[model samples]
Target: MANLQLKAIKKSYDNVNVIHGIDLEIKDGEFVVFVGPSGCGKSTLLRMIAGLEEITQGHLLVDGVDMTHQPATERGIAMVFQSYALYPNMTVRGNLSYPLEVSKRPKAEIKQRVELTAQKLHLNELLDRMPRALSGGQRQRVAIGRAIIREPRIFLFDEPLSNLDAELRLEMRIEIAKLHESLGNTMIYVTHDQLEAMTLADRMVVLRQGVIEQVGAPLALYHNPDNMFVAGFIGSPRINFMAADVVATTVGQVQLRIEELAIDSLIMTVQQRLNEGEKVWLGVRPEHFVSADGADCHFSSTLTFAEHLGHTNYLYVDYDQEKTLVIEQRELEKHTNGDSVTFGINAQQSLLFAQSGERIR
Candidate 1:
């Protein structure tokens, strides 16, 4: 296991700076995930840690040793890429033993290591089969097994599950979690999928445009995002954003009124000062809206469509002239499209952000 520390890590192509100065500490035996959209530089950062990319100006320390200039093999890291990278002509056994053989390990040791890795990944029975004969899940397992055979200090996975189907991805997620528990090695995973990032990471690093947005546990980031981008990016079905204006301000609370979608004024607790008539953004998650039955509706809209996902219901409502609100319901009554529906949200459940797109917590 290895604890990694990156100090002012940066990357640039010619005069174009992609990764700005980034500082992060990854603890030993911990599973950390780097999550962001494409062009956000998550993969580039991962490659830099693996010693595959040069650090423009920073230090890379693994297990208290500086390895910024070390070669990929000398950095004690094993990476499993999006593509399986398996030799189609070679059997699983051959693929597993190749790295060990190349490193000049004894024949007996290589054999033992290959069998042990296969057993750990549940690929023992498929050892004699080529990768072409294996399913996507099986091929991914083989890729993982190849990484495990090295027993590297840290495991780097560059969107390792992106190639599999939804069901296989879920299965492989469980397998990877179990594998981490069994090995207790430091692992770094890179992916744009927020669901995978939420489920697999002990701590997640949310990146945007090659810079760190927020770093915390999955639930922590979900419940308490530091900025507007983090709150909107982490949640599913997307969070609803409404333009709001400050109507009044008290000692501990501020009264707000919707700007675009005209609505009743609501008071929310605020530690930050809000000037009267100042514009701010109001964010409410889909799950926060409750069914409005014979009561005042804070949000009134026309039902555009409804989607049922087994236990949960998603209701898309068109509000005002252009705003669309998605309401999440648990036990929703049947309603046709174009039917009028009203939903309400508690003031405390909503978030306030400044015009600059920063949370006003």
Candidate 2:
């Protein structure tokens, strides 16, 4: 296991700066995930850490040793890429033993390690099969097994499950989680899928446009984002945002009027004071909507669409002329499309953001 430190890490192409100065510390045996949309530079940063790309500036320290200029093989790290990257002609046993063979290990040691790694990955029965003869999930397992055979101090997964089917992805997710639990190595995962990050990471580093937006536990970032970008990116079904104008301000609360929802006045607690007429955004997650009788603030809208999952239903209604607001519901009531539905949210469960996209506490 190893702890990693990144100090003012940056990357640029010609005069175009991609990664801004970033400083972070990853604890030993911690499962950290870098999550962001495409073009956000998550992969670039991961490659930099893997010694595949040169650091434009800044330092990378591993286990208290500066390794910014070290070669990939000497970094004691193994990576599982998006593609399986297995040799077509090699059997699983060959694939697993190739690294040891290249390192000139004793034949007996290579045999023992290959069997052990195959057993660990549940690939024993498929050891004699070629990559072309394996399923997608099996191939991925082989890829992981290859990495495991190296007994690396650190593991890097670059969207390793993106190539599998949904069911396979879920299965592989559990497998990876179990592997981490048993191995307890420092692992860094890169993915654009927020749900994957939420499930797998001990902490998530949310990035946007090559800069970090937030870094914290999954639920922490979900419920207590520092900015609108983090708030908007970390949740599924998306959060609802409504435009409002501050109507009044009290000691630790502000009263607002939401014209889009036709709300006359709603009071919400805040840590910051706002001007009487300052524009702010009201943020509410889908699941925060409540029954009308239990609501602090309510509005009515015609249901434009409804998605019925097994345990929950998502209701969508048109808002702000072009935007749609999604409300999560778990009741047994059935409402057809175009039916008027009343949606309510407690003031205490709502969040307030400034027009500049910063959360107002």
Candidate 3:
């Protein structure tokens, strides 16, 4: 079993602290992804798990054993770095065989393990090829094979596909996902790319300034965000926000006056009670808008720009106080610049957030 438990994890540099007390749990054979903006300490936390970074304070328990200050080699963990760290002078077989041979495994055992790993990664044909002769994808596979050959209980990936082009990244994503399925080892991957986090993770840990903002399955965090930062950060086009006020209240609903909308008061159904004239922020996704004639809240805007992405269109419009609004269009007529058009948003789909950025469900 490879279950990991982090107790009040903390890290610092020269007395300047980062990685605020972080507590997390990882079950055996689970795939967890750590994602956040740059400098958020996802990589630092992963390194701590690998025993590469010293923990300032906290207990790192793996399978109920404290391995916090253990040396990396004895931690039963293998890491795949952003750069494919292959030995330039070594062939693929040499790289995969080195780890087992160093552990004093029998020669026959090393050869068997190397051949099996090569077959699993489809690198058998290139086993004799040097790193210099391999493409970006091939080199990365060899790197992963090197880690797999050790049969470690845990795998750590730190932005492993960031250097590859978009197409290569997609291909590698599939390859890594397949590898995880075949291995069933505890895997912790870190990346700033939301798409990667969304697609690859069984659970996602969203962090900010070294503190975890939220953790859950990708869609759970997407549809039911705990705060504004998560709602804005999780989506591709990003969610929209407008300053609003509670004008009145009724049974199971509240009337809101959004400054950006010309409409008087739009009814929003909610489970929480609001004081009359209380200020709040309302948000909706880009694709939540409808034609003005069909919507309760309508707002006119000058079309600043539009993009046609073959199957869909992205509309950027200039709205109140120099704020820009993005509307996603699919199965709708194409729009162009300078067009004065009105759009509508559904009250039920709208999200309310307190001034402090907490979600008000």
Candidate 4:
């Protein structure tokens, strides 16, 4: 196990910059996930950590030793890519043992490590099967087993479950989680799927446009985002943004006038005082909306769409000409398009953001 330190890490292509200056510290044996949308440079950053991509600037330290210029082999890191990358002709055992063989380890040791990896990944029954003969999940297991046999200090995964079906992705996700628990290795995973990141990461690094936006525990980032980008990116169904004008401000409270929903004035406590007449956004999550009965605040709108997923229901309402509000309901409600629906907003749970997308305390 090893800890990593990235200080002013950066990457560029010719004159164009991709990864901006980033500074982060990953603890030993911690599972950290790098997550972002496409073109966010999450994969590029992971490749840099694995020594696959060269760093254009800054220092990378592994366990207090500089490894920025080290070769992949000397970095003591094993990587698993989105593609299986398994040899078509090699059997599972051969694939698992090839790395040790190339390093010229003892024959008995290689055989023993291969067996242990296979057993750990539950690939013991598929040891003799070729990559083509195995199922996709099995192939991924073989790929993981191949990496496990190396017993590197750090493990890097670049969207390893992207190729699998939903069920297989879930299966492999659980398998990977279990593997991390058992081995207690330092792991860095990159993915565009926030659900995967949320489930697998001990802490998540949310990226955007080659910049590190926020890094924290999954729920911390979800519940207490640093800005609008993070608050919008981290949650499912997205957070609702409505225009609100600061009608008044006091020691620890701000009175908001939400003209969009025809609300005259509503008061909520805040960490900082806001200037009166300043325009801000009120953000409410879909799950934060409750039934209108006995609610602190409420709004009425016409339902535009509805999605029922048995355990939970999502109601989409037309907020304005440019936006739609998604509300989550625990109890299933039968509603058709264009029907009038009322939702209760929990003011205490809501968030406020400046016009520039920065969170306002």
Candidate 5:
């Protein structure tokens, strides 16, 4: 296992900068994920670490050795791409041993490595089968096995599960997680899927257009996002944001106007400085909403739609100003398209963001 470090790394195409100076230190054997929307530079950053893309500036170090200018073959890294990229005519054994063979390992060593990788990946029974004969998941396994046979110090996966079906993706995700545990190598995975990053990463780096938005453990980022962008991006069914004007401010709490709702006063603890009459956004997660009366704030609205998902339902409600809010409820009773419903939330769980989208607390 090896630690990877990137210092002031950058990339550009014809002087149009894509990756703005990024610095990170990845501990040995740590599973780090780079997650963000497309065109956010996650993939470009991964490729730079893999030595596939030339660094426009700054340095990259692996195992404490500078490798910024090294060739991909000398980086001691293996990558599994979204496409399996397997050779059509090559058998599974051939595909797995190809890298070792090119490295000029002894014939016996190549055979042994291939056999071991096939066994680890459970591809022993399909060793002689061509790529065309294997299913999508099996082909993906072969791609991974090829990487494993290389005995790389670090592993890089770039959306390796994107091409698979949903069920297959889940199965492969578990398999990859188990593989990491068994191998204990430094692995960096890049994906746009938040759930995958949340479940697979020991730590995650969230990026926005050529910039790092936040870095933290999955639950940390989910519970306490550094800014509004991260707060909205990291969760499923996203957090709801409402426009409000600060009505009152104290050392520990502030009151806000929730529009025309009869119960509009919402008090939230503030960790940052804010004066009265300042406009701010109120953020509340779908699950933080409660149907009972014991809440810090309460509001009534007309239900516009409800989606039943077996155990729970997502209710979309609209107020008079056309602002829509989503609420999650269990055992939802007597709710329809035009029925009025009241939802409440605890003030401590609510998030406040300034006009700049920076979290106030």
Candidate 6:
């Protein structure tokens, strides 16, 4: 296991910058995920760390050694790509031992490494099968086994589950999580899927448009996002945002006007620097919006749509002013598509963002 550190890293193509300066310190044996939308530079940053892309500036260190100028093989890193990248004609054993063979390890050592990796990845039974004979998930496991046979100090995965079906993806995700637990090596995963990142990562780095938006544990980022972007991007069904005006500000409370509903004087214990009459954004997660009353913030709206999701339901409501809000409900009562509903939110659970899309507190 090795700690990886990137300091002021930057990447450019023909003088046009794609990845801005980024600094991150990944602890040894930690699993960190880079998550963002497509074209957001998550993959570019991962490739740079893998030595597949040139570092325009700054330092890349692995285990306290500078490796910015090193070749991919010399960096002691292994990568599993989204495409599987397995040789079509090669058997599973051949594929797993290819890297070791290239490194000129003894034949007996290569065989032992391949056998161990195959066993660890649950591919021992399929060792002699060709890539075409394996299922998508099996092929992916073989790809991972190939990386494991290399005995790399760090493992890098670039959207490795994107090509699998939903059920297969879930199964592979569990397997990967278990593999990380068993290996306990430094692993960096890059993906656009928020749920995958939330479930698999020890900590996550959120990026947007070549810039770092926020970095935190999954629950921490979900509960306390730095801005509207991070809050909206990190959650399933996304957090609901509403335009509101600050009606009053006191020492420990602030009044807000949401469309026609007024949150009459809510207490905010956190010290927030905000001026009077500022237009701020109010964010409420779907699960945080409740059906009961007695909340600091309450509103009544018409249900535009309701999706019955077996265990729970998602209610999409529209205010009189035409702003839409999503609410997640458990033990949901049957309601028509356009039924009127009232939702409540605890002020402490609500988030306030400034006019510039930054979280106010």
Candidate 4 lDDT (Cα, 0 to 1):
0.91
Candidate 2: give the clashing pairs.
none
Model 4 spans > 4 angstroms off:
none
- List ranges where model 1 is wrong by over 4 Å: 293-297
The alpha-carbon lDDT assigned to residue 274 of candidate 4 equals: 84
Model 5 bad stretches (over 4 Å): 260-262, 320-322, 332-334
Clashing pairs in 3: none
**For model 2, where is the 10-residue window of minimal lDDT?**
264-273
Residue-by-residue lDDT tens digits, candidate 5, 128-242: 9999999999999999999999999999999999999999989999999999999999999999888799999999999998889999999999999989999999999999988
Task: Give per-residue lDDT, candidate 2, residue 176.
Answer: 95
> TM-scores of the models, in the given order?
0.97, 0.99, 0.97, 0.98, 0.97, 0.97
Best by lDDT: 2
Which lDDT tens digits does candidate 3 get at residues 189-270? 9998888999999999999999999999999999899999999989989998888888899878888887665655788887
Could you list the CA RMSD of all candidates, in the order they appear? 1.4, 0.8, 1.3, 0.9, 1.2, 1.4
lDDT per residue for candidate 1 within 295-344, as digits (tens), equals 23366678999998888889999865766888898985676899888788
Candidate 6 lDDT, 1-361, residue by residue in tens: 9999999998899979998999999999999999998899999999999999999999999989999999998999999999999999899989988888888899999988888888888888999999999999999999999888888999999999999999999999999999999999999999888879999999999999888999989999999999999999999899988777777777866777775555545545447756668788888899998754687766777888899988999888875466667889897678888776877778888998888998887
Q: Give the alpha-carbon lDDT of every model.
A: 0.90, 0.93, 0.91, 0.91, 0.91, 0.88
Residue-level lDDT for 238 in candidate 4 = 93
TM-score of 1: 0.97
Query: How accurate locally is residue 241 in candidate 5, as Cα lDDT from 0 to 100?
Result: 89
TM-score quality measure for candidate 5: 0.97
Scanning candidate 5 in windows of ten residues, the lowest lDDT window is 258-267
